[model samples]
Target: MKKIGIYLSFAALLLTVGCSDWTQMEPVDQQPVRPSEQNPELWAQYTAALRAYKAGSHTLVVASFENGSTNPRVRRTACAAFPTRWTPYR
Candidate 1:
């Protein structure tokens, strides 16, 4: 049948093209490399900045503005509760 001939031609084409030599490709290493290996001071400074920012430093202030509108009374109450730590945004 014509269908059998078409299927046979497709199978022969696939078999001839699929025999590629992939052995020349480079193998990937399984070991993980540390950042300090590339640059020690750069890695150290990066870690220090991360620590400083994570500890609630003013360098990276987070604002909360998800709720509908910010209530003036709530803001005043929060500022009154923590005056030294709070800095109002204009």
Candidate 2:
């Protein structure tokens, strides 16, 4: 009887530790879908930025914007639009 009680206690302990509420603890999917992954124009802009940086012409980096706008607002918008590739310089 004592042996059976010990075995049952161990089994209960194992059961309590092994079971988890993974469904409640799972991470939420809050990420927005990447535009560059889907859009060709955005991908091209990213490539051009990389090329401009490599060519040692940081000014030309923003000039590659297909929208033909030198406006700082437009540039900022373009920078925010593709964060995965472009990082703001100081």
Candidate 3:
């Protein structure tokens, strides 16, 4: 009885702990924009910035992140630190 009680408790704990609520965004008709094709001006600026970074003119860190994860402060700081890559970063 004690072993059965322990097993039942463990199963209940596992079931509850494993449950999670999922959120779904409203559906969109259009496909998502590709990074390179998003903006011509920003693409040009990013390329120029990449070249400069390669030439040792300045350090550059290219980060691929989701829109939901974008932070306002990080965007502002990245733009302020390196103007050329600003548009692409956003």
The C-alpha RMSD in Å for every predicted model, in order, reads: 14.4, 17.4, 16.1
Q: Any runs in candidate 3 off by more than 4 Å, and if so which?
A: 1-30, 57-90
lDDT of each: 0.74, 0.74, 0.72
Number of clashing pairs, model 2?
Answer: 0
> TM-score of each candidate?
0.37, 0.29, 0.29
Candidate 2 regions with alpha-carbon error over 4 angstroms = 1-36, 57-90
Per-residue lDDT of candidate 1, residues 4-85 (tens digit): 9999999999877786555457789898778988899999999999898788646656896354445645654443455566
> Model 2: how far is 1 from its true place, Å?
13
Those runs of model 1 whose alpha carbons end farther than 4 Å from true positions after fitting are: 1-20, 23-27, 57-90
Query: What TM value does model 3 have?
Result: 0.29
User: lDDT tens digits, residues 1-90, model 3?
Assistant: 999999999999988777643344667799889778889889999999889878886656799634444455566445345555437634
Clashing pairs in 2: none
Steric collisions counted per model: 0, 0, 0
